[model samples]
Structures are given as structure tokens and as C-alpha cells.
Target: MTGNGADRKTALVISAHAADFVWRCGGAIALHQARGYEVTVACLSFGERGESAKLWKQEGMTLEAVKSARRNEAEAAAKALDVHDIRFFDLGDYPLEMDRDAKFRLVDLIRAVQPNFMFSHSRFDPYNTDHMYATQIALETRMIAQAWGHNPSEKVLGAPQLYLFEPHQTEQMGWRPDVFLDISEVWDKKRAAIECMQGQEHLWTYYTNVAENRGNHFRRNSGGMAGGRPARYAEGFETVFPRTVDELG
Candidate 1:
């Protein structure tokens, strides 16, 4: 981490599906953009295969409809965060298995951008195969990005620090948030970002709850409400870097 807050930071946020980013890390993206960081969003799938309840049975909710709506939503959300680049791999939804080809494609993306930080779902999520698989792909892609022999397209950019975003179902694997980012200044932007996923408004209430919950954590730890946007709200992550205390201390 740089001491100067004005440093140009870059971040890549990967998710199993389109709406996942809105639910998981929309606020974080907004926060990054507010700090002048370049942000990239990559979705493994459009989430056409996920459970839709009665919404899918509605008049015009075909699989294509869902995918198109998600694309538009992601676009609006990215714009709210000042993110210029958004990539969709169009992998199969619900169960996003990182086949050999898919893995290589993701690795190529990482090599191309070389973000300073990478955020994705946790591999410990057991209920969602797509989420778990997306994390697996991210993990493998991180390794491949640094490998000298593989991925000829990439010029061996050093590995970015990987962080696991808090999952929707946090109790399952238990989210241990080591880092809490105060995104109070961008909460409205974040809310608008989440509202971009109109197809999942009903499903996104869980995320609002999450933001409020994480906000309380931020307040408790930081000692007061801060930032330029709202009184509270944050995106939390667990750093996967294995380092000695000396490196941090």
C-alpha cells in the first residue's frame, strides 16, 4: 500500500456472474474510483443459469433477456464507479467450471492489465458452485500471470495482492475481514451502482443489509463516521498474502 492516498491504484474485480459484483463489491469499486484508481470488472458468466424464482417466469424474462439486462446493468454500475473497462467472458452460468481454455483466457486478462489489487469471491463458498469455481479460476490465473513459460501474451507482470470479498452467505465459511475500506464518501454512488442490476433488485436487498452491517464494523473500528459521502458503509476483505510481521510492522 502506498502512503500517499493520491497514488494511482488499479484493481480488478472478478465475479461468477454480473449481479455478483453489484452485491459483493460495488461500494468498493466506487471507493476506488473516488481515489482515482483504475478499475476493471470481469464477469465469468451472465448468470442466466441461476435461480430466478417467479421473475424468470415473467412475460419477457428469457435467458437472453436476463443476459442482456445484466450486461446493461453492469455497464451502468461500472460507469457510476468511473470504471472504463468491463469484460464479460460469457461462460456458462450457475456452474462456472474453469475449463482449460477458460482458465487460459482469464490468465491472459490478468497479464494484460497487471492490476495492483485483485478482488474475487472466496473459494470456501460451498453452496454456490459458480462462486467457488470463479475463485478457483482467479487463484489459478494469479499463478499463471506470474509464470514465465505460460501465457505468451502476458509479459510476466508481478502478482497482485489477492483479496477475498465478503460472500453473501458469510456464515457458511465465516468471513474474516482483515481489512475494512471506508467507502462512506461513495455510498450513494454505491447504492446507484447496486440499483443498476434492476433484474436483481429483490435479491439485492441482502447486499444493502450487508453494507449496513459492514458499516457498523467500520464505525466500531475507525471510531467514527468518516468520508465525504455518507455516515457509514464499507467493503471488507481478507488479504491472502503470506508475509512476516516485519514486512507489515
Candidate 2:
């Protein structure tokens, strides 16, 4: 509600699974939230089927139980990141799909938030089609939101940059980074959020390593030998649209 205010800056993240946002762009979410931006996360699924291997191994695990556990973890992580809002589509995973009605719901949300910019998964992911499908949903919904005839009464959505977060296997996913965000200040918050994903304990150290590596990249790109922002942690992104700038510097 507050994010819709004309003066407020807002961002939307379309996560394919419960922990995708946590593992991918938690730093960006935390940093931007700290900088007075209301960040909203839309999780397409709890990753109950494919991604809940740890939970499934626990002796007694049902679909509903897994979903509950995953949702709780997601909420905890969102709280750690100070997320303004979090929505769950509960559309199922392993092959996330959305019909016309579901898509319209997302388009409505996009209209309500009217985010300054949006975040989603890389365009292509061979390992996980769900990740790529979520990005497709984001793009389609964004376009639908801009259509004047879709919802004639509501305000037409403005063009917002869709930033694709770094995927797990960059080498195989063909994801290239065109932007690096310095999240040194909110690294602690992002780490705290990452810890909330108790289901995926194995990834705790891996994503931490990712931030550290990206921080090095940030330092190098910021000024290489000349001296850059001494960023201790960072996140990488690939913009789907061109950025309009008044000056190069």
C-alpha cells in the first residue's frame, strides 16, 4: 500500500522458488530496502517438489507439510531482508506454469506496485525450466501492465528495467553480468536472510562465496588498480533493457 504512493520508490522481484530470491539477490533487496525502497517479492512456488530434497529425506514429509515449512522459511528470510511484501503464487514447481487468469493476477500486482524497476531470473536456464518460466511470466505481465486496453480504468504501467539476477551456474546458463551492485553495507542483512533458508543448508556457504567473488568483481570494475569502492560483498545483474543516462560518468 505505501509503496504505491507517488513519492515512494518500489522494486519487484519475481522468484521462481521459495529460496531463489534469498540465494540470488538478497543483497540487492536488503540494500535497496535500506535505501528507502519498498521491495516486494513474488514467489511462484515453495519449491516443494523438486527443491525440497532435504525435507523429503526427513522420514515424514507430505506435500502440505513441505509447503508449510518452505513458506515459513521464506517469511523468515523476507523479514531478515525487511521486505515490504511477499506473495506466493502456489502454482507448483519443477515446471512452473501459469494460465491466463494467473497471469492477469500478476499483471494486476504489477499495476498496483508500479515498481521503478523489476528483478527476475536469467532468460535461459537449462537445469531448471522453472527459473526461466518465471522470467517469462515477469516479462509478459510487465507488457500486459503497459497495455492501455487491458484495464482501461487503471493507470498504464511505465517501462521499468527488468534486471536478471545471476544464476547458480553462470558458465552453463549463459548469464553475463552488465551491472554490479555494491552491497557492503547490507551484507550482514543478506547473510542473515540466507541463514533463514534452513531447508537448503548446503547453499549457505556457496552463496556467501558468490557475494565475495562478486565483491571482487565490483572492486575491479569500479576502478581496478586506480582504487574502487572497497565493497566487501556485492551482487551481479544483467539488464534486459538499455539504461537511459544523461551522462556517461
Candidate 3:
């Protein structure tokens, strides 16, 4: 298929679980969408096997029931973020493994979107290997999509900036964020999105606190007591690719 207009900017986010995007980078998604970028979110799994505790606590909840409930919550969360295209691979989690075909499918999506930038989990996560594995797959798929001989008919992908969003436990995950985004303007939308994940309601306040802390970091880095814009909420990211630019702003 052909690519979109050159003026149109796009982005893709690969989440290990259905609700990972909301917690990790919902603010970035909302902020970019507001900036007129077409953002596509691809959730690798529903996290039914492990991530959904509230649903599992309920009586008589089958595997399918849990998956359905998680899917509903993720869809609601995506909607709250104004995300129009959100896909669930449903490959399973707690040990999320993707076969060759699944990798190819991801490659196709990457090539099709031709995103200017992308977001994925941290490279290392001991607590949840699924998160790191998803990033591994994302890197592999991105490489495959860039290969000219992989699929001659499809348009090859460009070298887009791959930004790793913050992990749950940054110290353990060794996730040092270099980019701090002030999402104060879109904090309300991100908060609404965070609330939509009913399965992980306990994390709502925790993530809110994270945003607030990151906001403080943003202010400190931008201009520590030197008249920087006061921010109420923020998100952080570590870029995997070196950003090329004519001038550093």
C-alpha cells in the first residue's frame, strides 16, 4: 500500500498489556493527537493471565470473561485518550510469546503506519519479562520493516525515534528517562484514561503521583528556580534512537 501525505505526522505505540499504554504514555498520546498526529496503539495482549487482579477476584470469572473485561476497559481507556485506532493482538501474556507470523504481522503494521516516532516498554524488566520481550519484538519488527528485501511490494519504514516509556519500577528496570514531557495541559484527559482501566484501579493514584513527581523533575530540568513554565503533570521517556536535528532547541 502507498503512504499517506508527507505533511501528515504519525506515531505507533506497542504495549505489552492492554492497559500499559494508558499508564506509561497516555499523556504523550493525548498530547500528540492534539498536535494533529495520527496515533495508532497496538496492544500485544489483554493481560488477562496476570495483570487483571480485580477481575480475577470476582466470582466465576473464566479466562475468556477476564479477557473480555480487560478488552472493554482498554477500549474505554483508549477512547478517553481520543485514540481512534487501537488493536489487540491477543497473543496471551504472563509469558507473552509471539510466533513468526505474529512478528511479520507487527512488521506489516509498522511499515504501514510509517510513524515519525514510536513508544514501547523498557528494554529490561525483571519483574515482567513480557514488557521487555515486547520491546524486543518491537525492535526486531522495526528492523525487519526497514529492510528493503523483506517485502519489496510494501513501503519500507524510516528510522523513527523509538522512545521507551517509564516502567513501573524504574530503579529495578534501570530505566533512566532523558526526555521529560510536561503534560500539564492534557493531564485531565490522561487522568480520565487512567480511570478507565478498572482492572488495575489500585494503580490510579500511584500513577497520578508518578505524574506529579515527573512534573517536578520537568520543572527542575527545564529551569530549576529560573522561571521555567510551572507544570502540574508530566511523563518521561528514554529514546532508543539518536535524534538527528539541524539545531538543538
User: Candidate 3: which stretches are off by over 4 Å?
Assistant: 1-5
lDDT, each prediction: 0.77, 0.93, 0.93
Clashing pairs in 3: none
Clashes of each: 1, 0, 0
Colliding pairs, model 1 = 185-229
Candidate 1 structure, TM-score to reference: 0.88
List where candidate 2 sits over 4 angstroms from the true fold.
Answer: 1-6
- Output candidate 1 Cα RMSD: 3.5
Q: Give per-residue lDDT, candidate 1, residue 167.
A: 83
Candidates in descending TM-score order: 2, 3, 1
Q: Write the per-residue lDDT of candidate 1 for residues 1-249, one digit (tens) a residue.
A: 311134546788888887777777887787777777778889888887684444486886778777777788788888876775889999877667768888888888877667878889876887887787788788888887788889565478575777889887788966688888877788888888877777677766777777888877877776554533334678888887753344552
| C-alpha RMSD of candidate 3 | 2.1
Choose 1 or 3, whichever is better by TM-score: 3
